[model samples]
Structure formats: structure tokens, C-alpha cells
Target: MPETVLIVEDEFFIAMDLQLMLEGYGWRVMGPVGTVKDALLLLETELPSVALLDVNLGRELVTPVAEYLKAHDVPFAVATAYDRPEQYGGEVLAGVPNAGKPTDERRLMAALMQLTGR
Candidate 1:
């Protein structure tokens, strides 16, 4: 089966772009959920093989979602404009791979591949 990736990002265009890119790479994309609440809702039903999270989701932080993923042993990386996501997300996000803003396809894919053991 193809690997699944859940995407948690707020920006509409960026989220869609990621969906397209991941699909192109033959991975099943779960979501580009815009809020922590929505992301959590999705997680309750199904767990993706890996996840890509945006550190800041509008006024909310992605920390809660990250915490859930970590607790479940689901691997994930952050995509953020911030140079240091840990500054915004606190210690839970420290040392996690960051794909950065504007989404470097190569780096993001590398991190995802590593996380999923693909």
C-alpha cells in the first residue's frame, strides 16, 4: 500500500500545493487541515504514516497536534516561516525536521521519506 501523509497547514494555497506534490509522488494524502482542532478530529479516526505540520495555524499553534502525533508514535515534520519553530511551539517541537516556508520539495520529501522509512 502507498504511504499516507497527513498535512496540517493553514495557508490555502500552500496546503493545496503540498497535496498535489505528495499525490504526484504516489503517497496518499490525508489532509491539509487548517486548525489544531480539525487536525485532531482527523487523527481520532485514522493515523497517517507520517505528517507535515505548519507550526503556526492562524492564531493557534500546532503543538497540540504534534504532541498527539508524538504520543502515538506517528512521525512528523514541521513546515514553517519561523527560523526556529521551537520558539513558537515550545520544547515539544525542538529538534524536529523543518521543511521551512515556501516548502522546499526536496527537503520536505527527504524528511518525509526518512520519517516513513520509504
Candidate 2:
């Protein structure tokens, strides 16, 4: 089976673009979900091989969701428009892989491929 990827970006257009791009490469895209609460709910049943996480989910930070993924050993990468991760203060995000927002699709695909070894 193809590697499954969960997209946790909050922006509708951005997330949709990512999802479409991943799907184009034959990856199974799980979500383009837009909040901490929704991410958690998605986590309840959908466990993907890799996750693309947005640091800020609308108003809520993704630190909690990161913690959940970490505990479960599900590899994830943070995608954010922010430069300094220190500003977020999420314990779970320390040393985790990340990609900047407004990132190119090929680069994002490469990151996800590296994470999933595909």
C-alpha cells in the first residue's frame, strides 16, 4: 500500500493544494484538517505513516497534537510560516523535522518521502 499522509494545515487553499499534490504522487492523503480539536479527532481513527503539521491551527497551537503523535511514534513534520519555533513553546516539537510555510510542493514531497522512506 502507498504511504498515508495526514495534512494538518489550517488554511483551506494551502491545505487543499498540499493534499492534491500528495495525491498526484499516489500518496494516500488523510486530511487537510484545520484545528487542534479536529486533528485529535482525526487521530482517533486515522493513523497515517507521516503527518504534515501546521504549528498554528487557526487560534490553537499544535503542541498538544504533536505530543500525541510523538507518544504514538508516528513521525511528523511541522509546516509553519513562523521562523522561530521557540516562540511557540511546544515541548513535543523539540528536535522534530519541519518545513517552512509557502514551501514548494516538490520540497514538501521530498520531506514526506524522506520521512516515509518512499
Where model 1 places Cα greater than 4 Å from the true spot, the runs are none
Q: In candidate 2, how many Å is residue 118 off?
A: 3.4
Q: Compose the digit string of candidate 1's lDDT tens values, residues 1-118.
A: 9988999999999999999999999989998899999999999999999999999898999999999999999999998878888899988788888888887789889878778767
Q: Write the per-residue lDDT of candidate 2 for residues 18-116, one digit (tens) a residue.
A: 888889989898877998888889999978898989888768888888888888999988787666654793667766666778878877877776787
The pairs that clash in candidate 2 are: none
Using TM-score as the measure, the top candidate is: 1
**Clash number for each model:** 0, 0
Instruction: Show where candidate 2 strays beyond 4 Å.
Output: none
Per-model C-alpha lDDT, please? 0.91, 0.82
The 10-residue segment with the lowest total lDDT in model 2: 89-98
The lowest-lDDT stretch of 10 consecutive residues in candidate 1 is 109-118
Which candidate comes out best when scored by lDDT?
1
